[model samples]
Target: MPKGVYLRRAGRFAWLAFAGALLATPVYAQKRTATPQKAVQQQPAALTIPSDPDDAFVALREAARKNDADRAAAISATLVDYPIPSYVEYFRIKSQMFDSSGQPLIDTPDAEISAFLQRYQGEAIADRMRNDWLLVLGKKRDWANFDVQYPQFVLKDDTQVECYALLSRALKGQNVAADARAMLVDPRYYGDGCVDLISYMAQSQQIQRGDVAFQARQALEQNYTTLAGKIAAALPDARVDGDSLATVVKMARNDPSQAAAYMGTISGNLSRDEQGAAWGVIGQFAAKKLMPEAAGYYRRQMDLGGNQWLSDESQEWRVRAALRQGDWKQVRQSIESMRPELRAKDPAWTYWYARALKADGRGSDAQQQFQSIAGQFNFYGQLASEELGNRITIPTRTTVSDAEAMAMRSRAGFTRAKKFYDLNLRFEGNREWNWELRGMNDRDLLAAAEYARKIELLDRTVNTSDRTKAEHDFTQRFPMPYRDIMQRATDDVGLDMAWAYGLIRQESRFIMNARSSAGAHGLMQVMPATAKYVARKIGMTDFSPSMMGDPNINIMLGTNYMSMVLTDLDSSWTLASAGYNAGPGRPKAWRTSLSRPVEGAIFAETIPFTETRNYVKNVLSNATYYAALMSGRPQSLKDRLGMVAPSAVTTTSLP
Candidate 1:
């Protein structure tokens, strides 16, 4: 095609494609044309500007993301009549406020930001802008204005903001040490807020010296050497050496035993808390490596300085090490030592603690623990239910009246969210939608999910329905779109349809054109290399990576690949699910490391990679629920997992 003709066709195609997405039953039901098109296509006949307002809006957003204030303003000027004007205005204003790295541009007046917030009050974008401005105000130490705006910032999800908020409180002579310790668990997001908080807290003597050492341990564990050094400098005695901390972190990565040995040599010169922190780091690395000595290292840490200085994450690692070593006593003790609130937050810890109780012959106590988590719908929840002799079943489906569903169509948030979704701006769309879901009752959630389904926002439909506490619509939550295509694909490969659906639900939430950060694409999140490999295996001579965007082609290739992994892993769902996620080699190597047959749940929990461990558990749990929904029979997650035995002969390679 000629350049002029191609551009016109692309512009028209982009609008028509978005239009089809709005009206289609499932957004991906409409197939794309063979050729790829640019998001912001311009027709030659329309001078240098984009032919469509939405295309110009897309360009404005790209400019804003780059913090190109001039370009954003120029493009946004052409989008005066754009369908989503709030976002267009938001980008124009935001571009002027922050540089490309998201640092606030110096001398940007706070009045301009407050004006936007005042105009768009109670909207998601306004709340988001408040979050941005609070960071700026916090950095500038403009606590007077920050104090006024902090409570109005609705989401409060940003950790750095929380840090700054705590810092502001501490400045007012309030004790915020406990709050800082709780919120500063993750150093990756510490930024200026957390780093400043720690410094101020230490200088004021509000937090104990042990707290500073713990912060250093957390930073070193995350490989934040500079942050760790800063934390060490906050200690009054300067007893914890920054260079020694760096050496221990490096040694832990390569060899946990070496890290332990180095810690042992330095133990006498260090404070008890520092000694414990060093030992905790070694234990965490060793636990991740599945080393049997991990439990002993944790015990040594506890023996030296008690568990008072250990972070919640370090305490969790202590439990994991015990679970790996099958040391029930250590598991029980470590869990009991955790802060009550932290221990109760994660059901995985509860489940393991219950298992330890049962292993220690405290059956009634274990039963009580199991009952606490049993009727829930997550991975640990299902496992707890099976332990209580119950199978997973679909909750009774809830109904939404037509009037109730119709009401969502008039909601301002939903309307804006739909507009963003139509423009393919999912981040903004999700924020708008989720912000509306706060404090909603079960019936309201069901109605909102119904509205989502009617609008072909199937992912939103699933997520919205999944939030209901007392009522549910299983059909809405586990939406089966393109059933005929999915059915045929699974049948052709002799794959279990429910299992395929389960994996797809976890993989992409049925978003047909979904693409992961690692470059996995389509409904199945098939990697490009894996798609080609499956294409060849299944005799798809004309297959290309672009073809993977098709729901039919993607599902077929994904299910075929699923079948291959299952066959390679001896048809174990647990192993195959892990293999599908982390790769065949990892699960294979994990299985070989097992000394004897263990329950599949143990194998999943013991998996070293956090992503793969959670993926396997969720895939199996989803498969159980999908099976129950399809078969109209209570399904056993335990039976589905079965036993994962040691296998010396395991596949080490696959696409």
Candidate 2:
């Protein structure tokens, strides 16, 4: 979700409010039959219908949003000459696609949906209709129809849809266990479709009991007790039951030592995988708590059964625990013990593994690992560059010609995407935009990014430009909008303008009225309380949270807060960036918990909160690129990161 999407949604709701009076007396506004008055009014005339087609369409849009099929039908009936007949028809069709519970209406004919898909074949809504229909088909076990339509789902980003697709293939005697395993890591997204896939695969012997057990561990780790119970029931063996697994997982979460003891009591009755999984769970919780015993638990986990039973998460936590203890050998061993696919997927492991190699006098091997990831542009990639004795610099800019950019403006997909963006339907707009970029060459991508910038969609500009392989455009990727306002704010507090802009880019993608779900507002994503606190600190007694919507005010308050956080955290940009995202209290506590001085990358890796970890990495990496752009010189990400040392005393004075 975009930061400040709620603020944008508020604007969308304003349109809904405009038609609220008509909606108040909706044609289907009758209450339950238990109310005598409602029963009498059930057959009332359509007196509330608007004469204007636009107003009628808006009413229909609102009805569709509420999933009021009867009202939508009543309103859409009056939009006979609506300019956007596609949308008018779409709202009507969508209202009937699913019932109030969001399940596909079994009575809705597939022919009607197929007709809509054929009518608006390449449009975003048509694809959305197909997605809705596919779910209905999947639920009904109509794999024949699902197979015919699944290829047309343009985004294919929905996990449930992917699960269904995999399930469809599995029903046809195809081996999809590996693919299903990869997709089923996050139990939170495992709807009935994924659950069905796992159950079927388990029953048919396509997937071993270990696979189901692994999923059960994953479910328990996420506190999805019911899901864990369901998955555990799929295990063929009686020893691996839900109640026993949940008890150990719950114990591990609170006290790893207790869980370790509990595991010892049952070791004789459990399989090797079961024992390793329990130890892995204990180690994960212990490591996250920064417990000193975490390393030993991880060691025991490995000793029990090595990497085969360890989840990717467990292996990563093992590396984290080893890093915290400064055990280079353990770090190397833990990383090397990771599944080959997992090791290759994350560069953090590769970078740390390289460091471990260097620490052990394996210089040539370490150099190879660093060289493999150095050319990429990311947190680890930049660190690897520095390890290889190279400074971070911008790749040569790839210019998109005016003619190429203009050509993109005329493309149907781009136009439709722009329309959706204008309507604040960002999800649809982004899908529409990306759908057209699949086969584009590097030059074409640059052109689309430039066109995205022209449309003032800075987020799209950054994301699209970031996709290029052979060509690059830093300006588009790291745009500096509201430069004068941001510069003035930064200068007022002796702050780094590049760093402030980088934070804003990450915070809001330069969206002026961006708002986060946490109630942060504007380009800075400054929370209401933080804005007020900054307002008082700056002696702006008259300030209100609404002022955060203004770029100037948001930047002023945000920069001041950033400055305060930096000062409180000993002027360390790494700590300050972390403080900015997760609040000052967390980084302060994290620093105070450290046993010794650690490299900035290691400190970032060990951050307990996943969001803040990634946030700090991206913000600093962004700052490096911004610094390069502003200074017209090579910049060092390592210099920005510095070294994070333990603090004997910590304070949470900054909010």
**Candidate 2 residue lDDT tens string, 259-369:** 988887787877776777788889999998888789899888888874665667788899999999899999999998887878888899999999999999999999999
| Top-TM-score structure, candidate number | 1
Candidate 1, 131: how far from true, in Å?
A: 0.4
Stretches > 4 Å off in candidate 1: 1-51, 233-242
**What does the lDDT read for residue 517 in candidate 1?**
94
Residues 323-379 of candidate 1 have per-residue lDDT tens digits of 766789999998998877789888998999999999999999999999999978898
Using Cα atoms with residue i matched to residue i, what is each candidate's TM-score against the true structure? 0.90, 0.88
Model 2 weakest 10-residue run by lDDT: 25-34
The residue pairs in collision within model 2 are 4-514, 4-515, 4-516
